[model samples]
Target: MEGIKRIYLLIGQKGSGKSFIGTLMEKEFGIKFIRVEDWAKKIKKDRNVDSEAYLKQVFEENENEIRDSLTDMDKIVFESTGLTEHFDIMLESLRRDFKES
Candidate 1:
């Protein structure tokens, strides 16, 4: 099997153009773009919860989905704010999924 490669994680503060950069990368490199907040919102809608605990749960659940999707793709661009405490989790997920090419 071909080893996974070409994973890019755009980390920065909110409104810092990470998503825009990811969009450009997607167009230029034919990579998939995974936006974490959008995923979290989808999960939240499904769970139908407005509490802090529920939001946290939604984020965690969606993060796993995002990670799994990234792991199986050849090229993926993940855009997120790097200020989160769970940033390490995102980095480790990418590192574990793809080898530098």
Candidate 2:
């Protein structure tokens, strides 16, 4: 079975070009790019919950979904806002997963 060989976590302030870099990676190198905020948006839309109150839950679910989708992928990039304390859980999970890879 194929597994991830490389992981890029793009961490920076908001309005920086992390997502742009991720997009460039996706387009130029065919690496899979996972944007956490996009996942949060989808989760909010699907669950109809308050994001501020349920951010941890949303991020946990996002991490789970990202992990589940990693099978057969070799390179992946995650675009994240490096400003939230709550995001640490997901970041740690990603680090664990990438280390295992």
Candidate 3:
């Protein structure tokens, strides 16, 4: 069997089952899940802002981590609201990494 690293971008509105899907993916694929909100808190140490700014910083930081992980991990699940510019930036960064890799 061939092994490939995957970076899943879960995009959905509130209460749209993003978390549920992430959990399912983790169980079914044995992939590690990285939630943007939790990552932002760990990265920035601030949780008082609204989702918009939080997600932006998360994307910026998470994208770098994702790129780094791709070299070692089999799969990484990026769980996010996917409704902000930050998400788009992260996606673009992922694409660039894919091309470079």
Candidate 4:
């Protein structure tokens, strides 16, 4: 695993124990666990909307914030679903930007 960046992503239905397993990784390996839903929840609270609409709106509106929050992080696990593809695109964009710079 030398020089390889390792990331563990757990995708599943809500209330299906994703956070429970994430907590295990946190305790056992000191991997930081970030619940993607928490961000949406925060945004929802900020917007004062209790609807599920905040789920997608959170990403659409705050993707940069989400991406920036992860800057320089290490040994982390992200529990996510819908945002995975968007995150991957962001990562690739960052890689290309770094190479060009």
Candidate 5:
């Protein structure tokens, strides 16, 4: 339906090719892929070795702030390693915060 919004969240460990799967979905289904890690990097730049991990943690911790970066889009796909300490917290927060609003 036009009013329906579908968001596919892909979760896995580091180097687990979650993005590869997302890419395939994008290519096959024309679904737009949005990687949370990329948004995290845009919000806070890190040059350290574990920057990816740090950005993910920051994103999950500040779900509200990151959510602001999101726009109204349907059939969206998000892939993450779920290595952040607050991965579940972020998901729960997003569910509660972004419900048909």
Candidate 6:
């Protein structure tokens, strides 16, 4: 698979402008914007359960989806609160796999 040309990570606190920037990027640059929190919320609702374990599982699934997208996508954007072990692990994996990027 081809490496992604660009990966934009928007890390910020709640009520910040990360989401705004992500939206702008998607609309203006045609980049794929991934909002992890929204996806996590959807997963929680679908499962009808609440637990850190399940949240972590959802995070891992999202990470895998992002990694998989590196094949066909040239650019991608991600919005996160910039906390959690899962985020750290995902960053490490991205660094390892896309060292050139």
* Model 5 / residue 78 / CA error / Å: 0.7
- Count of backbone collisions in candidate 3: 0
| Candidate 5 ranges beyond 4 A from true positions | 43-71, 97-101
Q: State the lDDT of candidate 6 residue by residue for 28-87, as single tens digits.
A: 999888888777876786474356677677678778777776667888888888677777
lDDT of 4: 0.60
Q: Candidate 1: which pairs clash?
A: none
- What's the distance in Å from true for residue 94, model 6? 1.4
Q: Pairing residues by index, what is the TM-score of model 1?
A: 0.68
lDDT of the structure predicted as candidate 3: 0.74
- The positional error of residue 55 in candidate 1, measured at the CA in angstroms, is 6.3
Instruction: List runs of model 6 lying over 4 Å from the truth.
Output: 1-4, 46-50
Q: What is the lDDT of candidate 1?
A: 0.69
lDDT of 1 by residue, 11-85 (tens): 788889999988898898878887877866766654654565665554566557665665677667777666544
The TM-score obtained by model 3 is 0.74
Q: Name the 10 consecutive residues with the lowest summed lDDT in model 1.
A: 82-91
Compared with the true structure, model 5 gives a TM-score of 0.63
Error of 4 at 35 (Å): 0.5
Task: For candidate 2, write residues 1-101 as lDDT tens digits.
Answer: 55436777888888899999999999999988888888777767556444565687767876776676676676778877756666787778778757743
lDDT of 5 by residue, 1-101 (tens): 34555667888887789888888998999877767666666656545636666655566645543454355555667787776556676777778755643
**lDDT, ranked from best to worst:** 6, 2, 3, 1, 5, 4
Q: State the RMSD for candidate 1.
A: 3.6
CA-lDDT, candidates in order: 0.69, 0.76, 0.74, 0.60, 0.67, 0.79
The number of the candidate with the highest TM-score is 6
Candidate 5 accuracy as lDDT: 0.67
Please tell me which model should have the higher TM-score, number 1 or number 6: 6
Name the 10 consecutive residues with the lowest summed lDDT in model 5.
61-70
Sort by TM-score, best first: what order?
6, 2, 3, 1, 5, 4
Distance (Å) between predicted and true CA of 66, model 2? Answer: 2.4
Give the higher-lDDT candidate: 3 or 6. Answer: 6
